[model samples]
Target: MPSALVFFTELSDAPSKAQRELLTLAASIGEPTVAVASEVPEAAVTQLGAYGVNKLLVAPANESSFLDHSLSALEAAVKESAAQVVVVANDNFSREVAARIAVRVDGSIVTDAIDISADLVVTKDELAGSYSAQAQASGGVLFVTLKPNSIEDTPQAQAVSVSVEELAVSAATAPSVRIMATEEKVASDRPKLTEARVVVAGGRGVNGDFSAVEALADALGGAVGASRAATDAGWISHDAQIGQTGVTVSPQLFISAGISGAIQQKAGMQTSKCIIAINKDVDAPVFEIADFGIVGDLDKVLPQAAEEIRRRQA
Candidate 1:
């Protein structure tokens, strides 16, 4: 096995838990080398070595107005390395980038992989983590994007000089699409919804009231999420939506409040380590997968739960 290229957006600093997990997966198939479009800081080198990365392939951040420059650089790195396996974090931008690289190299690509073997067999979750699907690439390179938090970051201490290599790449003539403008989202102190270990989510049973949901989430010191029905009703923003059309979250402990737990909703959060569902309807679909089910109206149950959580802290 040759070196495995781990594509990333940010590596000027330490690798995120997701990126570290990518390295862990890469190490299983081959020597894990980081491929980034950003300048690598000396401090980041030390961090990369902790995760068994001996080499870094960095393409200077693109200056052109075009968005394909970064993708082009990643594709070139994959070609230059000629690694049979490429690993990236499963996200919108990274998946798109991986797809392009797969096409350029005529490789087989798999996304949302939960586990991968050294032989390049990939294990993926389908139907919202309900069913398991495994695939083996017979020829060419194998590109894989792993779901966040699918694996824990375990550091492997190794001795080596960090060698940063310049990866040469030619940008494509024109991008298929371009962004006219960008809006910066307001920053928050809450943990990002996808990365949080604990998450509290609400659904249609709340009936447009997120007061209890937000309060309970705050009390638990976790991120808040909403079902598609809650978002469709305009109770919360689309970014907070947790379902098939929204983001997939695998938190350690997921508390689903007022959510009906349909197959669509389960697709987003079925991988949670433990689930507790609070709903007035015992017959609701949510109870099917709940580790603990509470039969009560969320309006009353949530406030009491929040109060109890706050009291424990006090």
Candidate 2:
């Protein structure tokens, strides 16, 4: 039977969506083996068991403390376990790790996969979201990076004992990059856009102001997002921008305020479960696909809506 290998990053909490999807896909194929570079808490281990992971592989720490060493260790683990399919999250670090693993294993990599079917077929969008493509892994090990919220959240009942093992790392051929001081930003109360269930976004329609959008998001218990126009105008942080050139978000609910709904922006959020648009122009492209459309000034409409939502919650 073919085995699936799932690689997880070291974080404070379990990756909810990635974990769920990997477990589901693993169960679909065969037994699932989870691999971690750092220590995972017991609670997280139990959660992984509930999701159907049969084994957990841990990598040893290195003197360099670089992810390249971690990637090498994971590649070795994959080869030792003879896993035919490897699933990783589509993040900056994971992207690099996936590339390194592919080169080490002489495998083919598929990035930003939205779905997986039997026969190891993966779907992804391309050409600035103008088209979709599907490919199958025919030879060698398959490396896949999944897009957030692309897979359904289905937890299974199969639980297994978690076993941890350290992977052996090889000596580097060249000197590794030196790291200096690292500063970690304090986390905010708002949900992370990539993990949020609901995202409220603003654009140039707000006239270079994001206060209303932020207030609305707070009222709805969601994250604040922005269009390229708003980010270019300095109305919001670039990290909050959603478009082809920015972060891709597929939330349960997406609300766009004063956004014209350009194709670039839609490419980032077209897969949302529900879309609501509040634009002064009824003919704005955003309203075409909006489940709920409000033709008015967001400045006036958002305040009322936010107060109403807060009142109901209170």
Candidate 3:
């Protein structure tokens, strides 16, 4: 089997759903090695083994917000493993790191990849999900940034003990900028907007209130999202915004409540497998692409839907 490297910057107690998906994909393609920017917790090591990762490479930790440490770690892992295929999370920072590594190693890179074959062919969506394209790099090394929820994470039949190795980062990789201070946002029980399999979003029609949207999202065990209008009106944080200028999500199901369904909003979630739009306007554009739509007041419609969902689950 060919050698593969997977990069994960966050050092959580265990692998996140997105990271598990990356590992699962890597295992399918080749012998998988995981690279992290910080020390791996015991729980994480155990979980990595469950995904068939025998090797865990740790990079020297640094305080730079520029992710220099992460880049150094990936660079060192590439050299140590000489992996033919490299997989990473599809995020802005990861893309930048992958790009730089591609240049350093003279490799080829593909972003937003949805699938990768054993032979290194990448399948991806393009032109706002209009085109499904397959691409292969013409080089010894192939780096790909995979989209979240693109693959399922299945554990190996048997778990193996993991071996940890620390990589030596070169001083030349130091960052030019340093973070002076940071503030952590309040944590939520809901899943991340970008990673959730189901998303419930609201817009200006909510009239600066998200209780109805939150109720439906919470009832379904999904994440809460917001349109640009809702965020700009101080109804929700910008982090919850979903649009061309905000975060993009391709979840299994998407619910749009009290939103006008403009083109900008579709640019972010047009790839969702199923879309349910709720609006009072029967002529709303969102209904054009929706698999299911309700022409009613979201305030009343959402709460009733949530109650029914809860009742069924109960």
Candidate 4:
């Protein structure tokens, strides 16, 4: 069997859902090995073994930026393992690293792949989920960036023992840039926007208040999202924006409140398994694609829905 390499910029105490998915997919393809820039926490190492990762490669701590270190580690791992298949998370930074790796290794790179078969055929959705496409690298190493939430992580029946390896990051691979300072973001209990199974989004209809949208999202234990209009209006941070120009999400459930359901926004989240739209306008475009629709003011509708959900839970 070929050797498959999975690369991550950081490893938390426990492997994240996306990380587990990547490991599982790599195991399915071949002998699964993981390369991370930071030291792997003991919990993460054990969980990686559960996902069938037998080899763990750690890059030496360096003064370079996280991205630079990640690039050096991944490049070294690919060469050391002669990995025929490399998997990465589909994010801006990872995509940049994947692109560089492709250029350096003379490999073909594919992004946003939802599935990869044992034979290395990659499957992905195209044209806003209106079409599905399968792609195969003609030859050489195949580098793929998988979309989050696209695959389910299933642990091995029994855990495999992990062998740790230290990677030597050459000076040439390290960039001249260095980090100056860093500040931690305000912590929130909500799940990440991309990885959340449920999302509640607000738009212009919320006027300037997100209390109702947030209440519903909190009640459902989901992440909060906002349309471009709301973000542009300073109602929420750009990080919460969900649309073509922002984050793309494919959650199991997506609720849109006060959003117009423009094509740009649809392009980001149309792949969601279920969508519910709430708006006062009877002919809103969001209603066109929503599995369920409510033609009522979101201010009143959202709070009521939230209360009902909380009540049922209790």
Report the alpha-carbon TM-score of model 3 versus the true structure: 0.96
- Candidate 4: minimum summed lDDT over ten consecutive residues — where? 169-178
Ranking by lDDT: 4, 3, 1, 2
lDDT tens readout by residue for model 2, 1-314: 67888887663356565567767776676678888777677778777777777777767555455666667767877876788888888787887898788877899899987776666888887764457899997788988888776777676755777665666656466636544556788888998897688899999999987888999999988999999999998878899999889998878899999999999999888878799999999799998878999999999999999999999998
- Clash pairs (backbone) in predicted model 4: none
TM-score for each prediction?
A: 0.91, 0.91, 0.96, 0.96
| Model 2 misplacement above 4 A | 128-130, 173-175
218-268 per-residue lDDT for model 1 (tens digits): 887789999999999999999999988899998888999989888889888
lDDT of 2 at 240: 93
* Candidate 3 per-residue C-alpha lDDT over 1-314 given as tens digits, one digit per residue, 9 for 90 to 100: 78899988865887788888999999999779999877778888899999899899888577664477777788899999889999999989999999899998899999999999998899999976778999999876899999998888788998878889988877544466678888998889999898899999999999988998999999999999988999999989999999899988989999999888899998888888999999999999999989999999998999999999999999
What TM-score should be assigned to candidate 4? Answer: 0.96
User: All candidates' lDDT scores?
Assistant: 0.84, 0.81, 0.89, 0.90
List pairs with backbone clashes in candidate 2. Answer: none
